[model samples]
Target: MRLFSQLIALSRSRQLGRQFKEIERCIKALPRQARARLGIQTLREIGQASRMEFPHLYGTAPEARYLPWGQGTEIGYARALSDNPEVALRGIALWLAVAYHETKDCTHAALQAQHRQLLRVVRELKESHRGGDPVQEWMNTGAAA
Candidate 1:
């Protein structure tokens, strides 16, 4: 019985890991799409390293949020792009998924407001992406400043 219980625990842990990876996958996918949209082949293509960030891995939260040079969609626009076979938006989708996940999390009751903000960000992200070329917008934004 003890062996069986250990096996069950192991299985459950693997399952949870898989679930987390799936969510992480979604978040990671968006940056790839954004990278393509930005036309980056290498870090040097992004210009001076001081100003631009090399595309970081998806799970790295601080780096994942921004496009090169601190620009890119910050809203939930991924739902729209994710539908596109090309030019997908994976991050915003996870932002919402994270929010939805939070809704079901054990900490849900305590973090209701934070979850709501995440949902709002997703909605705004989609709207923001709908406007003029996001790529151009990001590049143009704050360039003069």
Candidate 2:
């Protein structure tokens, strides 16, 4: 029984790890600006996925939350991209998968919220990619925009 439990835990970890790697790969393949936009979308998707997947893995549902980054998805993307690309991508991928899973596949609301988060992270990521240039900002300043 102990061995079985250990195996299950290990398997779960591996699965999540694999998912993260996939996301990282996707992120790395993106163009610089696209990477930020993609990261934002990826983050939002991951949040929703995590929420959906939580119940099966943990026997309880988790809530999806938005990252605080506004319209500056690129800033976060650039930051994460600058870090070991593989590591950052994997982490974000895992996050998105977990979020998607936690949400039980019903993520309209979460996705909407994440869309806003994505915009913010992208803008922030853009500036970072630009060496902190204030002029190089994401145009969509407001939440709705």
Candidate 3:
């Protein structure tokens, strides 16, 4: 009985550690400029995007809660700075990492490939424009692509 209790406590501790690590990774993944651009409305939009793109990655219907937190909440927050190419790139990387960590399946590999393509597009956009509203640029180009 004591051994079982210890095991349960250890499991909970590991789960909590993973959650905290993911949170930290999300924060560290985005740059200062990207963080400045992100807002609640944008985050909601990203959440919507996550919902559309990978609903199955999260919980069941209705709430569709994301593991370690709510559905897309972490990714949405991390990816909110869509205007910043670095942010967008890092966000996808984080997403891929999380997906791989969670499932280690073909889906993870597929997303990895898809996001890699997206990173290239973002890099191109970043290089093309010298200085302007990144948000506007993303809306005009990144969002479409």
Candidate 4:
């Protein structure tokens, strides 16, 4: 009975992992800017999903509260600035390739370099995004709408 119970639990956990992979696949199907949007959305959804799965994970312990913000706030804010279209598109391409390589178990230094380059471009674009919103300007003037 103990072995059966453990096997059942393991199988359920595996199924949950597969479900998470499916969610990731859905995000990868979108374009770069779209991926960022969906990435945010998926993260929010996962929070809700986790609460539904294990309510104990929620709520804080008064004894020792760990704020996730810490020193990562500055880094996170910098990354957030790169949420525009051109850089976002490039980021998405890099992300897709990375995800593919990861899923296929074929990670390489060049792939990491490509991803880092996209991140750098996104950071640069974000710094200049306020100067002129070319993506928005072109979209506003384009026919794709």
Per-model TM values vs. the true structure: 0.26, 0.36, 0.25, 0.30
lDDT of 3 by residue, 1-145 (tens): 8677556545534543454355445545656444434223233333443655453343224455544333433563356346676566555444433332333222334334434543443343345334468788778885668
Q: 12, model 1: CA deviation in Å?
A: 19
lDDT for position 61 in model 2: 22
Q: Which ten residues in a row have the lowest lDDT in candidate 3?
A: 99-108
lDDT tens digits, residues 19-86, model 2? 43554465556667666554555555455534542322321223422322121222223444555755
lDDT of 1 by residue, 18-116 (tens): 443443455445554453432222122222222423321122256455532122222323432456633333433323343334232323233444445
- Between candidates 3 and 4, the TM-score winner: 4
Clashes of each: 6, 45, 1, 0
lDDT of model 1 at position 129:
42
User: Which candidate gets the maximum TM-score versus the true structure?
Assistant: 2
Pull out the clashing pairs in model 3: 66-71
- Give lDDT per model, in order: 0.39, 0.44, 0.44, 0.38
Per-residue lDDT over 34-110 for candidate 4, one digit per residue giving the tens place of the 0 to 100 score: 64554453244334424442222222233323442122212222323364644434333333322222222213344
Q: Kindly report which residue stretches of model 2 are placed more than 4 angstroms away from their true locations once superposed.
A: 46-95, 99-145
| Rank list by lDDT | 3, 2, 1, 4
TM-score (C-alpha) between model 3 and the true structure: 0.25
